[model samples]
Target: MTDDKTLGVYDEKAGDYARLMDHDTIAPTALNKFLSALPERGTVLDLGCGPGSWARYMVKAGFRVDAIDASAGMVEKASAIEGLNVWQADFSDIQDVAKYDGIWANFSLLHARRAEMPAHLARLKTALRSDGRLHLGLKEGTGEARDSLGRFYTYYTVAEIRDLLARIGLSVSDLRTGADKGLDGTVAAWFTLTAHG
Candidate 1:
């Protein structure tokens, strides 16, 4: 993401964010399901991996994990996890082709601008091997806005997201939606979709 305010907030509150999304509470059901869909020991990319919670879990599960986040503070925290290869990078920096067996983009692409999502998703699709899986999490709604914490968000309804993914050549296989309290202390509706490239 290029938004300075959003990156700054995550930079300053990296620890708080990490603690809030603690290991066990970071959507284990969806995570484990995604893992089960992947080939054993398959390479994975934790795109926009904040605090590396998911990445760390995948590493422990024996996946080769490459994690990246835009916030330096987030990178610092994630880098500390043994066996995780992490770095500071924006969504636009993703350029690999047919390299990963799965891509975990939970709650991260929402930080991107609305106009940039298609290109970003395309890059992710291109980076995946045939039948590679992609797990995406996004706030469910329409349009874009800033959160209480000054972080930018681009929301999409289920249909909108499904169509977008289809246009990008990702076939949706599973979807789940719910409301949850985030680090900003307010409840928001969100959705997760599992797709294959």
Candidate 2:
């Protein structure tokens, strides 16, 4: 699937997708080891913050939260919610400079085209404060494909993720791979990595 098509898919279904993802209450346990390392009350940026649920969680936790999503409809929905600084923008267009203390990409970066990832990683590194925490998640697999919903996705093994992060001067602090329960009773092999800039 192309980027345009994927963004349009999201824009068209922002409300449905937001409701579908509203169940994220606590941080997923797979992310606990990484979350434990963050300094208290620090600023966090949520990239591709689909429904802003995670951002809302961070807000309740007392951290300042900024959210960005490529889907304008998603942004509209997210911005209406209290306690979120939401922006409508693509990942590659971000220009924040040494601003966030932590960055959460979740499953969002999987939509990135492979060749575009390195540059985006570099941009993310530049956007962070020194040694800022980065939590990223991607599916464990071999190639790009569209999902049943016709959204674009790219898969990567843990090694590929590590190499890309290392190339941009980030080092993994903790990494894990396994099946995770998803919405709609689905299970998927996911790689969760916490890295530092």
Candidate 3:
């Protein structure tokens, strides 16, 4: 589910968040894995596609892209990108059935409360065709917290992530854990997983 308080943070700081284009993307190897898993010319849905950076990246990489975010400001910024199908809606409520060949939830789903995660993940499975790919990025930790900027976040351990994916009928293909600077200048632990249903 979408958290109104967290959405408010993104809405109010959309420009600052857009500046996240500075660090911008996952590793090249991860990119190659994601592409190799998809069908040639397949469509991709970018959940919580803040600022359109990855939407632009995926389009350039040859996938058709549909990006959505709950923040109106995020939608405004992302919609400026030429040819991007940017929508203003919460990803948890996404109702498409078998519509995408890949779902890119890069650091996006973390905003949802843990209690709300399973249902939304089930939705992701419903959104994808059989064997469709999922590239997920999540903060690595055991619980939830709010950032200095007031954005709510739910973190997970690698085991928790694996279990969550498995319960949703996804088969884990690869998992990578690392650290990166957060928007607040703190070192953040993160995990990236590649899975297929």
- TM-score of each model, paired residue for residue: 0.98, 0.89, 0.94
Q: Could you tell me which residue pairs clash in candidate 2?
A: none
**Candidate 3 lDDT, tens digit per residue, 17-123?**
88876465554567678877899879999888888877887888888999999999889999998878998888667898999999988899898989988888889
State which candidate, 2 or 3, has the greater lDDT.
Answer: 3
Candidates by lDDT, descending order: 1, 3, 2
lDDT of 2 by residue, 1-197 (tens): 13988888888888777877765533456444554577888888999998787787788778888999998888888897688899888888878889988899988899999988888888888888996888898888989987766778899988898998888888886677677654434667887788886
Indicate which candidate wins on lDDT. 1
Weakest ten-residue segment in model 1 by summed lDDT? 19-28
Model 3 ranges with Cα > 4 A deviation? 25-29
lDDT computed for candidate 2: 0.80
Report the Cα lDDT for residue 80, model 3: 91
lDDT of each: 0.93, 0.80, 0.85
Decoy 3 TM-score against native: 0.94
Q: Which candidate is the best by TM-score?
A: 1
- The alpha-carbon lDDT assigned to residue 23 of candidate 2 equals 59
Residue pairs in collision within model 3: none
